[model samples]
Target chain A: MNVRRNLAGVLALCAVAMIFLPLLLTFYLSVFDETLIVFPPHGYTLRWYARIWPEFGAALRTSFFAALAAVAVSLLIGVPAGIGLARYRFRGRDAVATMLLAPLTVPGIAIGLGIFVLAVLIEEHTEWAISGSLALMVAAHVLITTPWVVRLCLASLANHDAAAEEAAASLGARPLAVLWRVTLPAMRSGIVAGGLFAFIVSFENLEMTLFLTAPGMTTLPIAVLQYLQYHIDPLVAAIAVAQVVFVGGALMLLDRHVKLAQVVA
Target chain B: MVEEEHPARLKSVSKRTAATGFLGPATLVVTVMLAAPLLLLLRFSLNRFDIKELMIETVTAENYLRFFTDPFYLGVLRTTVLVAVTSTVLCLLFGLPLAYRLARSQSRWKSLCMLAIVLPLFVGSTVRMVGWMILFAHGGMLDSAVRWVNGVGLEVMYTPFAVVAGIVSINLPYVVLTIQSAIETIDIRIEEAAQSLGAPPGRQFWLVVWPLALPGTAIAGILCFILAMNAYATPYLLGGPRFQMMAPLLYWEFSTNNNWPFASALALILMSTTLVLTACSNLLIPRRYRA
Candidate 1:
């Protein structure tokens, strides 16, 4: 029994280490005073973090807007879709669910390539050029994020009591009023979860963004990649550390509102 | 009851129209934006690349023919599949024990471990790859640690080993989480019953728990395989210019070489292979146990 317990403990520790060691190392690397990332820094400094604005400021803003816009657009489409799927008994409902979730299975690179090809073809044929457009990037991100919003909202609405909405309606409440007061409130947690999922997925996404991003309008991850290709500096580490800190804060908020286990399941 | 009046108030045709109103926008966006582009990819792959014109014009099988005929491309496909398979199996081996532990334990530490698993998903794969690059680089932390123990340092960057390590690290959390969820569904009473019948714990797991969790574990394996196979940032960053994966190769064809037909062909191959494999696996698993 002791042996088995010890083995379990060891495995658990290894899993935790695998997940966190890289993040800790990245944070540690960011503070190194040396320009190049090396073990055992001579001294700690915040110069790299300070310098990130000049190096990656525009890309950061672009990524931020792109993620935020993607979240908003996905919610606009995905919330209604989720409600329809969860509440309505419609023809081809299964097909709609599959279509919404199908993007999850396709390779991101393939999606990016496909979108790029279509954009290029559109440019070839029409006056509408979507190659470097922020709208284009958000659209691509919506393709990636809307699935999460739909799935989570659907899950949230799965066990919802429609009787309450019915009772409200029978009490002379209009459909819009019931939706605004009761249904939306019931699915609030799911919408929040979905929005968080959508934001993170859009923000961290690289493969699809790789194809959509134009020269001056690059996202932060793309900028980091380009930077990495040229220089292996603590500045990139600083950017990474910044992202980790932001995500870590968001995660703490998520933990407070939702059970991580339930979310994953 | 108010039901008769409610049905009279909300006609079936109106209900259908309302459903369409709610669902139509998403369906249109997906059809126009996502599905249409894929169909276009299929068309692009069939056409021949025109260098001077800078786009595919004539229909030809040359791109795919070149892919299948060339040993170099074949070697790349092999390497990509091998790395994906190896890392997936590794994730399974490493993740299962941790997942089992998380599922069975009621300790506060379990919650912490679960948090650790989900946290990495929020962090960009690019940053994680960069972390791996630093750790495995010559004179990096891993080298220093190894040297302290063995009196010799190691250079791991730009190697398949580095790529596989990155893939495993990126995927392990997901594999563990899925398996843990699967294990959560198995009734604890069955394990107790097995124990009461004088079965050893390991025997009970193999006889009772393993069969129930097998489908989930298999699904986890498939997910890991697909992610590892389609990996872009990790392979591009850690694998360096020397190593070639299917994704980076496709990116190069489209981005650098300006060969849209070939790139489309490559994407079709990669995407189709993934779809077929997933389909086959789903078929292999019985409908009842499949997730």
Candidate 2:
């Protein structure tokens, strides 16, 4: 017992230090007066934080709106699709499930590049360039995140009683009422958890955002990347700290209600 | 999805259908927005297309042939595999023990440990990679730490070491989380039974705990493999442009050179290799479980 306990305590401490110390160090780096990231700062200032306000503001706006739209679109499609998959004994269920989850397995490069060149071809055909447009970005995010909502909502639905749905239908409740009253209420936790997961996923997303972002349309991650390419500055550090606050808060909240392992896996 | 159901259970199936209206809007959205574009990319890969000429529409296998034949491209593939495998293996080595540790702890501490384990994931990979860049840089935190202990410095930043370190740090959360769940899945009673069979602590673990944990480890390894192989930004930033992966090469070919053909070809190659590796994993792993 003693050996096991100590091993666990030490490892937990290490994991904590692994994540937090660096975050704290980055936070410290942000406030330093010196532009360079070297330790033992000469003075402290909030100038870098101010710099992010104007420079990265538009990128933040784009990211927020993109993620918002993505969440909206995924919920619209995913919640229903989730119900059908989880509740119905349909043929080709396995194949459909695999198709839904396929994007997760494929390397993102294939998806992004494939989508990129495809968008261009559409532009030629339809005379509209959707590539790197906000709508395009939202569409990409939805493709990626919908499975999250579906998988989670399915899990929620699977746990509930089907008899209730049937009973409600027999009572002359419109199918919409049954879903709004019986189904959604039952899956609310999962829906919220799934939605939150989707939101966070959308929030911190970058890989897809990379190929998708044009010059005028950039997300926070892309902006940081572009800035870091030219110069390594504390403004990034300032932004990193701000983002961590939100992430840290969410992690604590999720860890409270549901096991992250269950939610994530 | 809107089937006729009871009013109390929330039926308005028909009206609900009418409410949402467009049944396959998202599907249409993905097909037009996602699928159509990718198909065009496949076409572009075959055609001789460039920034200046746009498309000559001449079909050619030259792009595919060149990528396969070129040593530069071949070397990038090799490095990508090496980085992916080494980093994934290392994460498993560290994560198995760490996850096992997390699983056996008290409930109060378990939640904290879980949060701590996953905290690294929440930070954007871009920011996380930057931290790693600084940490591994000469006279950086890692450098200073090594120097303080050994009276000499370690050169890691910008090397494969730094790249893999960044990879492991970024991916450590997933591995540990997987291993933790794997450990959780194995009922503790099985290990107890092994103890009653007069097994030593080592046997109790290797024979009982190890076997039970394999599936989770398999999953953990696969995830680490995917992240390592598909990883773009970390290597782009930390690995530098000098060290390349399959993903970034596809990126460079498409974005920098404006060679969508080569990029598409690279994308296909990447997909093929990934599918092959994944198929191999699926075959080998579950078979091992049965055996």
Candidate 3:
């Protein structure tokens, strides 16, 4: 028994290290003084951190606003859908739920291509100039992110009984009043968790966004890709470290409120 | 009695109306954004490709035929399958022990350990690929360590091995989490029962635990396989331009070659391949083990 426990401990430690080593190395590499990345640096500097804003400012801004837009839109639509699915079961409930999550099952690249093709066709048919627009990218992001919101909201409602809302209704509270006073507040954690995940998903997306972005308009991942093609400097590493810290810190903080592990599990 | 029946009927009507009110917006977004575009893409794939005209609106299976018949395209499909399968298997092997440990551990740090596994996932694949790039680059950590030990630099970057390693790193956490949840469903008493009956540790695991865990393990494997099959950034970054996985190939056709018809066909083929495989695996699992 002791031997088995020791073995499991060793394996678990190895797994943690494997997951974390790359991220730690990324932080280390970001501060390397050399322009060309080498194994052992003679010295370190923080110049790469300063270079990120100038090099990737536009792309970063685009990603930020796009993700924010996606979060807002996804929450607006997804929470109600989650309530509808979780609180009430009607005909075609399973089908509706499946359709909402269909985006996740399909390959993201394919979806990106499909959306891109549709955008072009729309442009050709009409003079809307929809292709390569931020709206188009956010629409796609919403399609992906809404599913997460729906799932998280559904998870949040799973354990909580609907007796409170029913009691409110029985006591002559209007349906909308009951929803506002009782149901929505109960879903708060799920909504917040969903928005956080939606932001991360949109911010980090690359496959679908690749086909949608115009020449001057790009997301941070695309910017990093383009930079990597021509150069292998520490500036990209610095950007990566910044993203990791920001996203990781947000996840930890949110996990305290929402128990994100339970939602995903 | 009439009043009660009237209110009940009204309630039913209101219930449906509420469902529709809640579900309508999401349904509209998904249909307009995702389903409609995929349907249009299907039509586009059937249309003929012309360099000057871009797409000639004539129904044909030329794009699909080209992909099926061409040795180069077939080779890319094979490589994608090989890479996805290898990475999935490796993830299973590496993830299972840790997942079992996590599922059964009584330690106070269990949640912390779980968080550690999941943190990498939220960071996105591109960032993780950058880390691997540093580790596998010619003058990077691996190379330097090899040179110090054996007076020769390692050359692993942009290779299939590097791509597979990067994918495994990206996928391991997901596999562990999925399998952990599955294992948690299993009662520990069953394993203890086996142990009390004089079964060795290995025997207890293989005989008592493995059978119960099969469903979850299968789920984890399928999820990993699908994710790896559709991987873009990992292959694009770690596998380099020479590597020809399906997702990268599809993107190259769309963006670089401007072959929308072929790219659309490739997209459908990739999606169908994953879906069919997932369905087939589900069917293959014994009814007793299936959820």
Candidate 4:
């Protein structure tokens, strides 16, 4: 029994190490003075972190605003759709849900290529140009992120009892008032979690953005990838460390309120 | 979720309208942006690629026929399938134990483990692949560490092994989470009952827990397989230019060669293969365990 328990402990530790050690290495490498990302650096320095902003500032701005817009749009579309799906049973309800979630099953590269084709066709025939517009990028991000919001909101709403809202309605509250005071409040945690999921997924996305981004306006991932293609440097590691820290912090904040395991499930 | 509907009230009209109103905006976005584009891809795939005009208005099956008849494309398909399957199997092998541990434990460590597993996802794949490059590069961390212990160096970067490793690492969290959910659904008493019958812990897991978790495992397997098949950055960065996966190949054809017809045909083939595999997994899993 002791031996088995020991084995389990070792296995757990190994799993944790495998997941985290690469990240720790990245963090260590970010501080190296060397330009080529070599190990056992001659000396440690903070130069890479200082240089990242000047190098990747625009990409950071683009990724931030695009992700923010995607989150807002996702919530606008997802919350209402989630509430409807949760509250009402209509004919072909399953089909509607499946269609909304279809993006998850499709490969990202295919979606990228398909959307590119659509943009090209529209550009060829129409006077209105939208091939690399921010609007198109946000729309594509919404396509990828909205499903997550819907799923999370649905999970949240399913756990919420509808009796409270009905009580509010019966107490002379208008339908809008009931939704504002009762329904939306109940779905608050779900919406927040869903919004966070949307933001992170959009920010990290590359496959969808690759085909949609213009030459000058690219997201952070694409910028980093392009940089890596030409040069292997600690500056990229600095950028990576920044991304990991931000995401890790947000996730930690999220875990304080909701069990992420339950959220994912 | 069904509230008691008051049949005599005028509120029913609003409720009836609300469903369509709520669904319309999202449906419009998805249809216009996603479904319509995929349909366009299908049309392009059926058309012929004209060298001078980019794409001619001719319908032909030559693209797909060429894909099947050419040994190069056939080999790429085979390599793609092999890498995906290998990485998925490796992910399952490594992830299942951790997933089971996480599911059964009530310790605070569970949350920490969850954070560790998921935090990597938010960090861009570009970053993680870069990290892998540093770790596996010649005279880099992995090489230096191995040399320190055994007086020998290791070389894995720019190889299929490195590509497979990267795929397994990225997909591990998803596989573990899915399987963890499956195992969590199993009643603890079922395993305890086996324990009471003189079965060892390992035996209990094999005989009782494994059978119950099989459905979730299968679903997780399907997800891992799909993710591995579609992976682009990892194969491109880690596998180097010599490596050819369908996604990167499709990207090359469209971006570099400007072969729209061929790229569309490849995209369709990848999409259809994933769809069929997913359908098969759902169809084959027993109804009770179907995800």
Candidate 5:
């Protein structure tokens, strides 16, 4: 019994280490002074950190704005969809819910290709140039992110008592008023969590964005990938560390407001 | 009840209208943005490829036939399946015990541990692949460590091994979290009851926890399998150019070769493979535990 328990403990520790060691190594590698990474560097410096913005600043900005736009659009459309799914049973309700969540199940690369092809076909058939546009990228992001928003919002409302909304309605309040005053407030944490997830998903996305990006226009992950193809340096490591810190910090901060584990579960 | 009938009927009508109003924008967006694209992709996959015109409007299964008949593409598919299956099995092996421990742990730092597992997930696979590259690269950490012991450096980077390891790392957390939640739902008293009945630890788990946890394990496995099957960056980065996987191959066909028909066919094949496997696994699960 003791042996088994010890084994389990050891395995658990190893699992944690496996997850973390790479991240720590990325941070460690970023500090190496040498251009060509080798095992124990002679010295450490923060030069790579200083080089990140100059190297990939444009891509970073593009990713950030695209993620933000995706979040905004996802929330605008997804929250109401969640409310609709949770509050009412209408014809084709299950179908609508399934359609909304279908993106989560499909492979992202396939979706990217599909959207890219769609953009091409649309451009060929029309005067509007939809291919390689930021709007197109954001639209794809919205397609993916809306599902998560809808999911989290549904989760948040799963245990919520509808009596409050009903009470407001019974007291002569309009449906819109009740939704604004009561239902929306109830979904606040879900909204915030969904937006945060949407941002991360969009910002970190590579598969879908790879197909959508133009020659000069790219997102941060694509920028990192392209750079890695030509260069193997600590500067990329520094950028990676920065991304980890940004995402990790956001997760921790948001976890305090919304139990992200519960939300995900 | 009779007194409230009119109000109830009015409320039902209003509720239906409200539901439509609320769901309309999202439904419209998904149909237009996602559904239409996918449908168009399906159409494109049937059409003949034309280098000059991009796509010739015709219905043909030439692309699918080409993928299946070509042994080179078949080999790529086989390698992709091998990588995905290996990584998923590794994830299950590593994830189950850790998830069991995490689920049962009463430590104050449990949430922190959960955070540690999940934090890696939020970081992009590209960043994680960079980390793996540093570790597996010639003269990198693993090589340095081995050399320190044996005076001969190792080179595992850009290999199938590195690709599998990178994918396993990416998928482990997801499996762990899924199984942990499942394990959390199993009542502790059941295990206690088994213990009091003098069943050994292994038997207790097999008899009590395993059956209950089977559904979650199945789910986690399916998720990991799908993720691995569709993996792009890990294979693209760690597997290198010599090693080809479905997602990357599809991208190469579309982007480099500009074979939209072929790429679309590849995409459909990959998606269908995952869907079929997922359905098969779902059928494997006992009906009572399916919810």
Candidate 6:
């Protein structure tokens, strides 16, 4: 028992260490006011903030809007699907779940390529042109994050007693009214959690976005990739610090409101 | 009760519409449009790209031939599989024990530990990889620490090994949370009974707990395997020039080469490879339990 306890303790420590070391290192590096990102910086200054203000600011805004649009679209599709799957016994429900999850196993590049082909084909087949459009990018991001929302909301729906909805109905609530008053309120945390997941996933996604993004639609992740190809400096480190804070803050908040592990569970 | 039942019931059309109406839109949108398009896109592997046409106009099997025939592409394939497989294996090795700890702990600590494990799941992979990049690059903490230890210069940046480290670190927390909860459900008495029957902890886990936990682990493994297989940004950013992964190759071909047809073909091949790997896992995982 002692040996086993020690083993678990050590592994847990390693887990904490791995997460801690890089985070500390990144924070430490971000303050360095040097071009080389050298260790034990001669001193500290905030010269890097200037780069972010003028250069990366636009990319940051673009990524934000793109992520926002994606999350909204995902919610539009995922919430209804969540309710449908949760409420009804249907033919081939298992297949529906699997189909939603199919995007996960597909390589991001293939998704990129497939979306690219889709845009071209849509243009060729119809008079409407979606090529190099933000709508297409939003659609692609929706494809990625909707499954997470659906699965999460489905879990939430599963946990609720059916009697509550029935009770509302028995009390003279309309179907829509019951959904709004009882069901929607119940799924609120799950929806927020899933939406946040969708937001971050879309915001930081680089691979498929790398293909789908056009001149005006460059996201922060894509910008980082492009900048890194030519230059590696504390500019990215500064950006990393902000990103970690934002994504980390959102994650920690979601954890407080509802345990993230519950979602995973 | 008869009065209650009769008056409260919705019209049959209303019931049918409720069932089919809300569901059909998403099903058609996801399945018929996106899923079916992917099936059509799979043809890219069989045909060569025509630079002149910007579309795949010919079917020659050259692209697929090149992937199977060329040592360069094949090596990348092997490395991708190796990175993904090794990473998943590491996740299992490290994750299962941590999961066991999570399961055995109190509820508060379980949730706390779980929160710690899963909070990173929402953080974008790019952000984590960026953290790795900042730390791993020269003049970063790692180099300075290494220099202090060995009093020598070491160039660890841009190595495939570094890329693997970044990928593994990002994926570990996710896989652990997945298996941990699955471990949470198992009856404690099962383990205790094996102990009473003269089985040591090792034997107990091997003989009993493992078989029960196998399903969750298998699913987690599949998730990790697919993510690692399809990973693009981490490999691209951390590996720099030397690191070649499938996703980046597909990205470059489609985006830069402008040979959309050929690029589509490569994507198809990548898709097929993922399918084969998954199929293999399903067969082998069941067989492992039988053994």
TM-score of chain A of each: 0.92, 0.89, 0.93, 0.92, 0.92, 0.91
Per-prediction DockQ comes to 0.53, 0.36, 0.53, 0.56, 0.57, 0.51
TM-score of model 3 relative to the true fold?
0.91
Give the range where candidate 4 chain B is weakest over 10 consecutive residues by summed lDDT.
B1-10
lDDT of 2 by residue, B126-170 (tens): 776666656766666777788888999886867888788777777
Tens-digit lDDT string for candidate 6 (B140-256):
667778889999756667887777777777777767766886776689899999999999887788789998888888877887888888888778877876789888777777668
By summed lDDT, which 10 consecutive residues of candidate 5 chain A come out lowest? A256-265
Q: Count the clashes in each prediction.
A: 0, 22, 0, 0, 0, 3
Residue-wise C-alpha lDDT for candidate 4, range A1-265, written one tens digit per residue: 6687677667656556656666777888899889886677899999899988899999999999999999999999998988989888888889989888788788888898999889888999998789999988998999989988887788789878999988998899998998899989888877886887798779988877889999889999889888889898888888878887877887888788877766654
- How does residue B260 of candidate 4 score in lDDT? 93
Better candidate by DockQ, 3 or 4: 4
Q: For this target, which candidate reaches the highest DockQ against the unseen true structure?
A: 5
Q: Candidate 3 or 5, higher DockQ?
A: 5
Worst 10 residues of 2 chain A by lDDT: A11-20
Q: Show model 1 residue runs off by greater than 4 Å.
A: A1-8, A161-173, A254-265, B1-10, B100-115, B179-219, B283-288
Error of 5 at A145 (Å): 1.1
Candidate 6 residue A169 C-alpha distance from true site, Å: 3.5
For model 1 chain B, where is the 10-residue window of minimal lDDT? B108-117
Q: Tell me, per candidate, how large a share of the native contacts it keeps.
A: 0.51, 0.35, 0.55, 0.58, 0.60, 0.50
Residue A227, model 4, lDDT? 88
What DockQ does predicted model 2 obtain? 0.36
Superposed by TM-score, candidate 1 places the C-alpha of residue A171 at a distance from the truth, in angstroms, of 5.1
**What lDDT does candidate 6 reach at residue B91?**
70
- Runs in model 5 deviating more than 4 A are A163-174, A259-265, B1-5, B103-106, B181-216
Misplaced by over 4 Å in model 6 are A125-127, A170-172, A250-265, B1-14, B103-123, B138-140, B184-212, B286-291
Write the residue-wise lDDT of candidate 2 on A1-265 in tens digits.
Answer: 5685566456555544555556666787788787666655678999988888798899988988888888988888877777777666445557666666566666777887776666776787897878879888887888877877877787678768999988999999987899899988888767775776577567667766777888888988778888888876577878878777776787778667766645543
lDDT of each: 0.84, 0.74, 0.86, 0.84, 0.86, 0.75
